[model samples]
Target: MGEYKPPFTITNKILSYISSISEKIGRITAISNLETKPHLRRNNRIKSIHSSLKIEANSLTLGQVRDVINGKSVLGEQKEIQEVKNAYIAYEHLEEIDPYNIQHLKQFHGIMTRYLVEESGEFRSGEEGVFNGSQCIFMAPPARFVPQLMDELFSWMKESKDDVHPLILSSVFHYEFVFIHPFSDGNGRMARLWHTAILSKWKPIFEYIPIESQIEKFQDEYYRSISECHIAGESTIFIEFMLSQIDKILDDISVQINEKNEYLPEAVQKLLEVMEYDIPYTSNELMERLGLKAKEGFRRNYLHPAMEMKLIQMTIPDKPNSRNQRYLRC
Candidate 1:
């Protein structure tokens, strides 16, 4: 109400999570230029967009979102598809955002909600509610209060940049932003995007981290954390909850990196170095991407070994020579 300072305590659980996440960050850093790995970076960004939209009840699969972003025709409702396209653009332009700038948050929200909401970048002039089907769970603060509320939140964030760990600060901002319900729609998406944006500013590697995917994986728990904190009058639960999610996501990333490093065939690893994964590639397409014209030598050294190692598999495994066949990383 007055000048808002988020109330929260860093308990032992939060400290442990911070410690674990830091160690995992060191491990994840070992993959030289992992933040620059095009495939990983693109895939993570797509995953973030897809999952954040999914949490908002957008009925599009991850592949469908990826396809939409790739400029392909996706058969879905016009509004849902537009949301995906908008989110993709918003994330791709994240470099233009400033984490502690109130205007930047409004600008990003405009990008996020574009055609999906009439209010877009503007704070709602009417009351809004968080709902479960027909039932409302929480009514937002009065619309008149939004601008000043947002100003204080951003001012606190800027002033606390040195005093707060980005992890803790971002999570606190995330919870508070959701509580403020600053926009007419897309608050959840903005919260998630800004959380990653805040962390990415802290360490560029976070640009490639799919923390939203983890939130989508455990969505019920995510809502529960917010609701509990709302009742408890502090964001400590949400802070610990977020730190726990980061710990889990970083752990998963470390495992994936080590698995590929230890087991993938050298040729297949090289192939992936050039390939954008989760989509299929035909033999000719694969060869062309690698700039190899001789089919047999290319197959023996790269394709066959990759298949033998199961790093990649044929799309039509039953008929390996199917004319319509393609290959995808496993």
Candidate 2:
């Protein structure tokens, strides 16, 4: 492990993805209202937790994950439900964790695997492997080598932090982390979390980008990228795969933001225009703001459609007809 650089090449295609992703991140973060938009941030964070857990065969649906987070009783396995809970708690502390510190990573893992794994915070004391059905796809380094390998990897990351682009830096760390397979049960989840954490440190908007959703959509390609890279003895392929995913996720967010009005009903679009993302408006208040005198028409053509499309969510979902109910743009 002497002077180890964790073997990865940056290609021109990777450069293109980085440029595009960086620009999108900058544009998104530059929006003044983003910091105050809880709905937007919450939606993305829930998707990330749900999708990452789903990739680990957690068997909980995205809606169920949201329900669990909201303290609603959901019918699911205890382990999967606990995974969602754990992930939510861990993600809430993203701003506090130091990505370059190995102890912080292990501490985060402890939080992530609490009540689930036998050795929550500790690296595997035995051999580990990546399995696909009954076949073994990759064998991790021996347990004795885990500490030194991880120490070297983290040292490299800290030393190179100022010199490398985070898109590449995080991607390399992800590939190397998986190859190390340090944890007994939560290796994949940790890899995804740390990858997001690293990017978020670079640009806070990344904490809300739902990169896990993109990874879950291309789970096969993710594993394929890892296997190909392992065979080639470098992370170049996986880095490219992840950069492409980030580029695509940015494009997806742009579509939902810019082109949603194209498919929305005219009434819904008009209603949304009258509302601010960070403000909650009661139906009567919204109607007054819209200069609509008829409650029935507004509810039928505007409110109902917006609610159906989830363009707006009721502040009191359980008691939608509550007098105190308010609607906020989602």
The TM-score values for the models, in the order shown, are 0.94, 0.83
Best model per TM-score = 1
Write model 2 residue lDDT over 1-330, tens digit each, in one string.
Answer: 548788888899999999998888766555433465456678788999999998888898877898899899999899999999999999999988789999999999999999999989999999999754455669999999999999999999999999999999999999999999999989999999999999989987788889999999998889989999989999999999999999999877765444456577778867876775546789999999789999999999999989998889999999988999999888
Q: Which structure among the candidates has the greatest lDDT?
A: 2
User: What are the per-residue Cα lDDT tens digits for candidate 1 across 126-154?
Assistant: 88876544556578899999888888888
Residue 315, model 2: Cα distance from true site in angstroms:
18
- The ten-residue window of minimal lDDT in model 2 covers 28-37
**Residue-level lDDT for 313 in candidate 2:** 96
Candidate 1 stretches with Cα past 4 Å from truth are 1-3, 132-135
Cα-based RMSD of the predictions, in order?
1.9, 5.5
